[model samples]
Target: MKTLQQSRAIIATAILGVIVSTYALYVEMAAESKPGYKALCDISEYASCSRVLTSEYSKGFGIIPKESALEVPNCIYGTLFYCFMIFLATFDHIGVNRLQLLLSLVSCASSVYLAYLLAFVLHDICLVCISTYFINGLLLWLVYNKNKQLVEKKK
Candidate 1:
């Protein structure tokens, strides 16, 4: 894709990621505050977003200790990541593209770990979580394509 087209695609994907992440954050907070709160994404007992969001794995990617200061919700990380992606996409420089590609790769790796937890460990299907995973994968593809285009242009 052309640089302009690639940038637009990345921006659009990041916007979707932001929206989904924001909703996940809202669900996380609302469920924490209100007792018996059920999110719209909470479809069923086995496929409950509330259950997944409220789980131990939802914060700090389930890697950081809960007592640690850096143990924030994953949605917060998701929000910041998409925002950073948007910022990086706004700059069309090769270095900026490289950074974007690297970030996307990292995000995808995180998604893989989270997905494993969701399926085997958590044993629940969270729509919101799945959506973010899909978004992350899409962003990785878009950023990778953009980087490949950039490299080919230099040939």
Candidate 2:
């Protein structure tokens, strides 16, 4: 019963993450294609989604060089991560739950780093970015609860 509820929560959170990541990807692409493109999330100069999405950190989390082959857009990574979370949550096995917890931990750490960059480095507010971070944090909480439930069940 609890497991089912947790699975549903994780799936729902991942779905929301997918939506926000997809929107960010669209904004990134549109900004690249169109000159002076402004996203709906672009509220002002400091709170501009377009500005953050097109910055140096937008691709490969500013880690990979632009000339590198692995330098894909960060939104693509987020989309794939959320999709995988949804799929993993479908399995109720202990191994699957452990994997989910591990992935969520990594995601949360990445979110913290990205949040710092957004606040300090970029000095810009991205609604889409913030939404995805919230979604990721929710997923981490859900996955952690699910893992706890599984351990309690085994005891």
Residue 51 of model 2, lDDT score? 91
Q: Model 2 over residues 60-154: C-alpha lDDT tens digits? A: 99999889988998999999999999999999899999999999999989999999999999999999999988998999999999999999998
What lDDT score is found at residue 108 in candidate 1?
A: 90
Error of 2 at 146 (Å): 0.5
Best by lDDT: 2
- C-alpha lDDT values of all predictions: 0.92, 0.94
Clashes of 2: 0
lDDT of 1 by residue, 51-128 (tens): 899899999999899899889999999999999999999876788899988899899999999999999999999999
Worst 10 residues of 2 by lDDT: 129-138
- Runs of candidate 1 with Cα error greater than 4 angstroms are none
- TM-score result, candidate 1: 0.97
RMSD of 1: 0.9
